[model samples]
Target chain A: MSWFGNSEPEPPSGPSPMDLAKQEVDMYSDLFTKMSGLCFKKCVVKMHGESDLNVGEMSCVDRCVSKYMEAQEKVGVILKRAEESLAAQQGGVGGPAAGGVPGVPGR
Target chain B: MTPVQQQDFLQHLESQQRKDSLAMYNNLVFRCFDECSKSFRSKRLDDGETKCINVCAEKFIKLTSRVALRFQDIQQQKAKDEAAGVQR
Candidate 1:
């Protein structure tokens, strides 16, 4: 007896677009978390000796967080410029060209 | 396109986009980690190392973009020269 009638339908080939976007967001969040952890270790020089945290250490942590975010933004800008140039060279209307305009709102 | 075919195409596009984003993230992590981990003997980041890592990330991005743009300029110039030569 053949088992063909008992076979289940194949699962979707891949994740949906919304699922993909969520995954991308999660991946970026994870990356930022890792960077923050590293930055915290760097910025927090002295342990408070007790459970209480010191203002100096807290300030440093804040600076580190801002710096990390700035770095990410810088990298993003570089990538965006590269993509824009690449798109311009390729003569494609999409890619970076669609999103890359100077002094544009919501960019 | 049929509904099933459209869904399949969308799925494929989503997967590719995810893969590309992952690759970008990996590249970033690698670059940042390498810069940040230079003084990794103590398993903690030093003040100097932190500063270095921050500067490194910024400079790396700048350098990458500059090189890419320079290469593109050269290619464009070469193409222009070739066209001029052909005209001559």
Candidate 2:
């Protein structure tokens, strides 16, 4: 009845390294989709006769993409902290602290 | 590591990746909404909205860092109590 030594063969714990890479690619694809949808909604309220984006619309999409990347970078920092905390909780050890990066308010 | 152990680790990592992706998606949607997409009348972001997006991202980062710092303090306290108890 022991968990680790159960007679039954355990299932694969998770995807292989290759599979992990594939998942990363998939995630990027999803990001692209989300970005396109958001940018379109923000920058293309009306469909003009021309397929090309106007100057204003072009600038908007550019700004949208830039902002998205900025948000993602911020999210990355928070995500690392989240993972560290989760690991610490599970393993009972000291967790990571913020590096106190300057320009990051709420210091 | 044994094959079983390796598999277990991989599974844990997979789940972690899933959680991370979900979090990113949610943050992007909410933060972007707050920054841009204010008026549907125009199909473009104004200068103010663009600036808002930058500030919004920075604010969210700060907020999470604050929470993480709090968690770290609590963990240190727990570790300290455990150490003190051992001395008794």
Candidate 3:
């Protein structure tokens, strides 16, 4: 799917583009599993009188997923800001102090 | 980026992704079982239990896709920035 912003249509050297695509799918699948699991824990109550999720629970989960992802982005921004400041303090742009942060979903 | 560094990052992502998928699997099974399995009178799932589990799975899948789309949008933005040579 032209992942990683690699717009060049380069021929395969080692790993095929299919391999990279699989990795990309794996990344998103894991993200979905982890994020939804967490949001379920947060939004769903242990006690349920009916088999179906109530309207409130459903809406809460909907909001929870969006907010959870947004929180990640917001935290990413703060993390970037902190890293940038640390880099400036170290007298360089994105010096060693600015790295080591893990990639978010899809990098 | 160098091949070694690229490999390291990909390994990191793979390991973390595996861990997250496993954790979610265990959590999903445990919680759904706990919530849906109420009676021990039979070895089979009752109607209510089956229905509850179905609903639970359906809801979980729904939530996952919803978050996935949101996540895709964010990642697409990041991809565009990276494509523009804005290194993160």
For model 3, the TM-score of its B chain against the native B chain is: 0.68
Instruction: Single out the weakest 10-residue window by summed lDDT for candidate 2 chain B.
Output: B62-71
DockQ of each: 0.03, 0.03, 0.21
Candidate 3 Cα misplacement greater than 4 A, ranges: A1-3, A6-30, A44-62, A74-99, A103-107, B1-27, B81-88
Query: For model 3, what is the error of residue B23's alpha carbon versus the real structure, in angstroms, after optimal superposition?
Result: 6.8
Q: Kindly list the per-residue Cα lDDT of model 3 for residues A2-42, writing each as its tens digit.
A: 25555334355544444554465565566567677787777
Complex DockQ, candidate 3:
0.21
Candidate 2 is graded, for docking, as incorrect
- Model 2 lDDT tens row, B1-56: 46975776567667766875577667655756654667866777776666656554
Clashing pairs in 1: none
The per-candidate count of clashes, in order, stands at 0, 3, 0
Each model's TM-score?
0.38, 0.40, 0.52
RMSD of each: 18.8, 16.8, 7.7
Give the per-residue lDDT digits (tens) of candidate 3, residues B1-88: 4686678657866786788767766776787887789999999999888877777766665566666666667667667776676454
Predicted model with the maximum DockQ = 3
Q: Could you tell me how far off, in angstroms, the CA of residue A32 lies in candidate 1 after the best superposition?
A: 3.1
lDDT of 2 by residue, A20-88 (tens): 433443454455556655665566544323434557766666677667656765877787667667867
Candidate with the larger TM-score of 1 and 3: 3
